[model samples]
Target: MNAATPLPTASARDTTAFLLDVLIPTAAKGPLMRRPRVEALAERLNLDRRAVTRMQKLEEKYPGGPLLLRLPIRKQAVVLLPEHLHAVLAGSPEPFSPASSEKRGALAHFQPRNVLISTGGERTARRALQEQALDTNSPVHRLASSFLPVVYEEADALLASIGDGDGATTDVLDWDLFITSWLRIIRRVIFGDGARDDNQLTDMLARLRKDANWSALKPQRRKTRDEFLRRVQSRINTAAPGSLASVMRGISEQDPAAPRDQVPQWLFAFDTSGTSAFRALALLSAHDEAAKKAREEIDADTTGGRNLPFLRATVLETVRLWPNTPMILRQTTTEVTWDNGTMPAKCGLLIFAPYFHRDGRRLPQADTFDPGIWLQDDVVDVGAREDWGLVPFSAGPASCPGRHLVLLLTSALLARLLQDTSFTLEGASRLSPSRPLPGSLDNFSLRFSPRPR
Candidate 1:
């Protein structure tokens, strides 16, 4: 066979630009949602749009190969092809590992033993515990009955707090209004009703995640991390009935699962889910067709259950449009052979999700509001023959274990909001179905006005 094509390394200037422009801004945006000012700056500068454009230009210059970034100490590969992205993501914990150095440094701030950063027998055991607790194999969680009610009740309270009238007067809903209510729901679902007001738990986690945004550069907040774990342990020990903590009770304490260590990741993931939920509301409010479809789905179901596929798809599209996890990084445990060339073991691979999800060049539906794509069976699976172009949740073995539960809660909340109320976008990020959507949506500034029925 002919020798594989050589991996094209970027110039030193390109490497510096990537770090300064793409990576730093994403980090500055915060690991969790603490940095609203940075979020506003990102949105104002159209940072994501600019980053995607840069990736596209680099890919065009070095077609059909992963672009190599020559850093000071080690090299990393930036994936250009969709097939490559799918393969690398799906082939996790093998030649390709999810526990990249950067990921390890970041997550170790809070969840040192998280499955994403685990290896060998430890990974196997911890993953099983997580999947069992999360109902990872199911489309809807096993505890859906228990979880859906929490969503509906909190959503109802939020609507009531907004203002219950003949629907004539408009009430403005923004991040503070929505997320405050959403976090209460998250705490109730994950920890129990007793922990519903436990803002300190989430706040401690936020501090660790802020330090995590610096990756290994920032010193570990040992005191804060320990206290955060203690708080998480307290909630888990309570195991209040009908909560995810309760579900985790089935696992034995001797399994070396590090169960308390896992809760921070859940808290962190759900924080991003809240952002996606807010953004979904914005998109539904702005795009008429999607809003109509979501409403139809809500109206078609009488049981008030969690089967809002269109609404779920809308959440997927919202993440796809403005990905919560923009940079998906992986480290190779063994040398990886690409179609173009072989990368050495321990090399990092960067899959800039925004580039793949919104590259207008590759995706015809890229720049518009289209949840319909997710309606199809397009999600690439491990060892599957098909390749996926868009990845909102990183696919394969290391995909978000809480995906179903997150979607269930998110879609259910969307259903509740859309059922009795109609909302309109109230800010500069208002989207129109006829036009290409803006690259950066400031979820913090995303405002909605509820109109009369």
Candidate 2:
């Protein structure tokens, strides 16, 4: 793999010229906004205030499309362009490896060294196991379907706690608690009574629930999790007749190496399913018109039967708008020319999908919350699947293996929520966009009042 090209002798002047000639002019009145760094570049280039503000907003929304910010780090900078993202993600593995360490760093906050986050043998093994569990015909989906009642019961409990809204203002983060509860339900359904009964797994998950940022507590949390896994492994070793634990135990017995990474599997299932479901619910609540339309679509097609296309579209749209894994990174394995620039091998490329979702060229009135876009007859012809445009579950060989599972789980949960409750925004007010608690990943906390039937 090659490294980044060295800044030219006239690098400073070159950057200024690029900002003035290319970035500033194009960013004016664009559908999206630019990142703050772009505006900083404009100021450095002595651009006008109006031009800088317009450029900055475009960068913020669009990111890495209109301009490039070369960082001090060798071969490192942000590429804020869609075509660049397409080149990195959709390109061949020889030229751009998705499993690159630079790409792995993006997921470091979550699964630091799991299969999805790593390359080579570890990644291969993890993918095998995940594929086994995620297979459409696998018992896991059967178990998930069987556990719908339990999930519904858990949601009901959360609703009971909130008590008919009663004009009570509650942070939508409480909704996340409901999400965690359903995670436990899936756990019970998949792992059976023994794994569900395991106090250590429950306690460790409780710690994770309490500490929202579990990745930061790596040292302490790892120890607790390892201990829990050891206990679960021991229980699996002594399993009786038919059970989910027995199935896992059978896998371990069939392949003794399986136990070595079972904990990571459990963690992946818990974190991804719980986090994605919660974020989807939060977004649905925030976009009530979208929610209502989705609910109506569900009602119309399903006739309260099952597996409505409209419901599917709503989940797809939600993930598209606010993908949990919003950004994907890759490292160039070979020098490649893309989007009018040649990036040397080993250069780090970050592909931002959340920003990509707002690209006008991709979707009609891209910023608007419309689920109907996916249902359109010519969605593919309209370029929905082109490159990095519609990658909520990601793209290419290393894309999310749990795509079908996640879609099913999210759709089922959303269907139940819509069926059980009538929803509206609380206090006749909208949430402040400035709240930093949810962070830049995705803002998921939007208050809502549930009307009692």
Candidate 3:
């Protein structure tokens, strides 16, 4: 049965070949789990969008090939299709462990037991505490609401800093205005307004900008992280009453085992929002009708005191193109079963959301930016879905706890920004001959200015 299945690679000497020779097949030629290639696989996803185009090509080239594929190691199989994602993500955590070895190792120095990386009894407890800490009740909802002013202020500041005439020619990302301002929002969200001036928190965030090798080179990395976490933990009570920090502290008291430094994980979790927001900048600038419609919806919300569904739809569309984390890896503690296949114990699984969201056959207008696709025959419409098919924030028990909060924040910020300012893509960025996504995100440039009154 295994001989009938082919993976993305066929090199005889590759580790993938060895896995095939040594391990039993998961039904057909589906992905093989060997050692661990989580980090390497994540790197490919992070470094280039074109990598996704290539992976899609592989699946198309091999119609009967395994939906999952082994890279070089045995520990991970990139789950290429939607059904595979449902198998790993929708299943119970007992079989598909929530803690991926890659996440645990990568975040080891920053946080030893963040909810995302914790395992065993501690993992379950941490997850519970993490949820309580982010509960959508009054306090947590208030925390999210409180940040709107910050978003308004920062969005205005970003527009102000967009510079006039010649300066508008500058790269949008090069100035780092949005990055810095966005981090401030994440900081304020987690640590409260008192964190506005905390240099140590700022420094810790700076460390996250570099690669693992770069961090490994810094001799004081561990000490720096330890000191930062300790200081933050001690100051939880100092956070403003309605902020995420205070909520985390309250939960910590209830569950003595809950780590005080949990807020940092929340801070890190939204880092992808920064990128997603920027992509919105690029996309909205290109689609004037969409931008105009979104602005009108925002205006209506302002007048009618309603939520802006159009803006939310735009955010979902952006995420569909670029999921926060394209490849989510999970390791199996027990044998995991999916339709027609059984993954043995200790197998590592990958969930590729980017591919799933963009699959043309399943999703209407997969490549089209029709936020209207999200419109259901309901009272209110926003183009995102929490279904197994579209798992930007993923689905099931171990899925992201901050999904609601993130969607709320993302839509609100974009709505505010679009209402106040107008953007145009820089000529070079617009004309770049990138193979995949039209304008390369790395060099995307947008000129923001006040809209006509």
Candidate 4:
């Protein structure tokens, strides 16, 4: 297997032309807010595997560790290999910065003051606060034990919404069902028993989410959030036992004085987790064989198997293939060099996950669905998840703190949904017959309800 293409002068020159000609067209498309636009473009290009097809072509032509591409604005160093991922993301601090995420700024549009967008002591403090909140010993972290029951209720709610399974079917986008369920879960997780059914923040966020300049309008959005923040703070002040807002407030006052803003920012993170889980569910529907195996495992481990390895393996594999966002960025604060390329300070490090996850060298059968690799860990073997760092949840200090919660929630949702019901894909969008991986079925309707006992 090829390690990576050695960066060359000729390829650098060609990379410019390739960016202008081929790759940009494959960039994100569709609505700015309601759903992920990358998934939209992936469907358009028939590459729901998200950047996999684009990166495959780049690898063939460029043959290098990292490709230097000239966009309309500036040159970006797109790193698509594992060593470089370890080098820049996990390896160091001074050189690679989080400002690259601030550059994208979609979610940041609505919440600009987010400690997440910037770096230095502010970002560090924010990250530390989040860690404490989700830490094993934290009272807030104890809510994890309730995931399966929550999923069961949410799943049943979805079934009720879809009508009875007795010859009655409702046609709906698969994302619609998944997100509806996730929103219910997140709402309850945040507000607990007093969770408001009406999610007013959704509309304000929708209006704010666009490709245009967002600074001027961020104030308006913040005003909208102000009321919601008050409501949450009130819940905390009232000391609602077991609400996320209350838990976070408790963590803040007693443990460390994490910003009041931390709770909402952390809440916003559920957007990606929810979306990623939805993607896994969509992919699982397409691959009946994998779903069957997962069902068997679910059947076997009924009592206290909190960690369902099969479903976790399947979710990990799906996330590796199609992360919520294909592009991860880091701005260079100082000069760095590796793999025949020079990354100047203040430039960019665009780490594309789809490319690295499918680098062929790290993961054999890189194009298809395979969970045995993750399952192989229990059976004893070095799999892609461990060896190469499959980073849908990302890695290192900046990695998502709720990664474990997401895995558990996703595993529970898939296991419950697939164990009882079978969904049929309908309409123009359909999964490919051969590969059964994520294909161009982004906008399809699904109809499923619980089976009779």
Candidate 5:
């Protein structure tokens, strides 16, 4: 059969199940993922596992499917096979556009001109500008020397604030405490040391992001957005020597590339990366071998830069095990031909990462924590080739421009925390190595107590 072959259309019952069990819960979590109540409920219900099982059954019903899901307003295609996923991602910005209608709607609230929501020559220019500023090609960014100390300083403050003055063995830590320190690091790294205490700025962005959760359905908060942008521009104007804002300022300006406009996305992305860092710590606490290896890498790196490869790999593994962006959405810019069938123009494509990441049928170490998979060249650069279907950062040309930089900061922070302390996962019963890790790691409820190693 050619691309026009009749594909398996989801039954009405299954369609409702997909919406309730997958899409609704995901959307409810908020694009910012700030809804703790929803997160806890999803974890207790094991929602991701339910979604995975549903997709698994569908795959069995129609092998190597291009499953047609009937949405209320439009039809969507779910990529069941790895090859189909590869094809859609690889042919992006043309046949398959990453700037899907839904994405444009969500990002428009905060970063309308950001590269993720742009296309054509404008996307190219903006992407090039961002890649240059972020040093996307390098594992350690050009400004790592300046950035490393900021990480260490903030990490130290975090440790000190959480520590008992009496030098007690363990210090209790949770999401609120960790995120407070993490945001400090993010502000300092992205803006400058001057922005270290800018709670008002981040708070404003948070309010805007909440509206963003509703996408275009929510009317634009022009007043709030304008103030947020003004404050962001003020921070950028400082251009402190070591920060990303400084680097962006130094980069040659390109037409239609509004550097300040991209700040919201960076701030937003760093929020998730911060969560990933905490989850990596949780993973380390639960798995002794991985923890030991991570410690060894930390010890071996005497540079104080803390840019350790294994640490980065640990972050990658955490993301793979529990992706922050669960469902990667793409829209067809033009009618596209697939192995099973042809999807009409503007059809949304859904590639649910948890299914592929934890699919035991394909990956032997799927359910286990294995950072070593990322250490391999073939796997690290899988975007250009046929992937094993592990896309924690999303692959291909449209992959995150800040991948290397985010990993660097996150890995450094993780390394700093693990250097002189031992952490025990509190109340994380499902994270042990002896069994399959839970599908949903409720990062909000995740708590850890640090002890002297």
Candidate 6:
């Protein structure tokens, strides 16, 4: 699974034919539609058929319902309305466990034995360890210190490759690869040096990014997961210092329960944080006006240096545009009745944040890229109550505890780039909704040139 391997390709006509004629009817019947679920959804949603067809080819596939035909394992029948998202997130722990269902498919298919994906007591324990490590008040300075250099190095690499200091065109999608690389660098920082060499983890994510059909990649992904765990366990045995691996290894030695608990902590931390950074970058690149505005704000606020306010707004705007986890899926823990309909226990529910963010009634000019929507009294007041329309980091108790850390990392990276450089899009007005890099994650390819002093 090298980076150069081309994904299976299909003609737009063939894709449309498959979807309008075959997949839609199959999906309508409540069956687990095959690799072309996006096509079926596009027909139902009346979206651009070609765009949807491309997305179908790129997205990872997953089980959709309980029954093969009559009941979907995971159906889009759940509320995509904004109010539903508010209700579901605001009602966590009582009717739903947000984190539990968040990545269930990824866990079940790839790392069934991993703690974060585990159900009941094991899930709780793994989550607790993760919370401890990710606590806002916890000593994240070490993690931050370890990550910052990597971030700078990645930015420098991108800038150097462009060769020109400013006004040079570079694909924003290529910038995404740089961001992805930086995220891996951070993971290595948090997990330990061994993570640096853990090619299996990298390959699994790379494969997952390209293959939308989840079932098709399950066997291979599982093998990669196993290899990753073996490497982590070996690292645990060595007990290297000043690393997350070392910390977990120390916990395992002192507390009997730690070995079981530590693995999921690493996985969740790496998975969620890395995804968040990548999505944030994608959103930023797509909205050039917003990115320029952020850079201007950063310039003014930093007094010719770095500014946190501009950085925060940029991150917030990006998350608003492209929530890392665009949709959150949950199974009814008990029979629940809502305004839309009555759902039985175990029925699948999907809360679509991307669509929710698009609802004009909830956000002014909702479709526009306006970072100012998050600012208050000329300050980055993300903690303010009126910021309800924004949920890139989600909300409530189960809201991403690492939200602050993500903001800081994204802000710092953007600030460094803005202060040192100026950029623009290449020929593309925005990212191609079709043929998005990695095949699934849609992102703009801006040709960035560094600013000269």
Which candidate leads in lDDT? 5
Model 2 residue runs over 4 Å out of place are 1-69, 77-84, 102-113, 136-144, 164-173, 193-222, 228-248, 253-292, 297-306, 337-341, 376-384, 427-444
- Ranking 2 against 5 by TM-score, winner: 5
Model 6 lDDT per residue over 340-361, tens place: 2344555555554554555544
Q: How many residue pairs clash in each candidate?
A: 1, 18, 10, 2, 0, 21
For residue 252, give model 2's deviation from the true position in Å: 3.9
- Could you tell me the lDDT of residue 208 within candidate 1? 85
Model 3 residue 336 CA deviation (Å) reads: 2.9
Instruction: lDDT winner between 3 and 5, please give it.
Output: 5
Give lDDT: candidate 4, residue 29. 38
**lDDT, candidate 4, 125-180, per-residue tens:** 66776676566223124666554566677767776556455534564535666676
Writing each residue's lDDT as its tens digit, candidate 3 over 1-453 gives 243332343233433442432222211111211111432333234433344454466566544223344454554555656665675676647677767665565555566667767767777787777777676322124455576776677666666555563435333433256767787777777777777656567567446433222223323367777776777786686778767777666555446345664666676667667767777766777777788887787777752212556766676667776566655678889755444354556667666565677666566556556666555652223322545367666667777777656666777777766776666665433422232343124322343434433
Candidate 6 or 1, higher lDDT: 1
lDDT of 5 by residue, 324-435 (tens): 8888888888777666667788888899888888888878888889988887652243232255788888887888888888888998899888999888888656797888
Model 3: runs farther than 4 Å from truth? Answer: 1-50, 57-73, 136-140, 161-175, 208-220, 251-257, 303-306, 338-341, 378-388, 428-436, 443-453
Runs with alpha carbons beyond 4 Å of true place in candidate 1:
1-6, 164-170, 250-254, 377-388
lDDT, candidate 1, equals: 0.81
lDDT of each residue in 1-453, candidate 1, tens digit only: 124544678888887877777777877887544588988888788888888888887887778767889788976888988898888878887888888999898899988888878988888888888898898878778888888888899888788766555442236787888898899998999988898899999888887888888788889989988888878887888868878888666555456787877777888888889999998988888777777888888889765666677888788888888888888889889776776777778889999889888888777888898787777563312122234468887788887788777778898899988888898788534577777788888888888777654
The lDDT values for all models are 0.81, 0.50, 0.58, 0.58, 0.82, 0.49
lDDT for model 4 comes to 0.58
Task: Write down the TM-score of every candidate.
Answer: 0.93, 0.67, 0.78, 0.80, 0.94, 0.68
Query: What TM-score does candidate 2 get on C-alpha atoms?
Result: 0.67
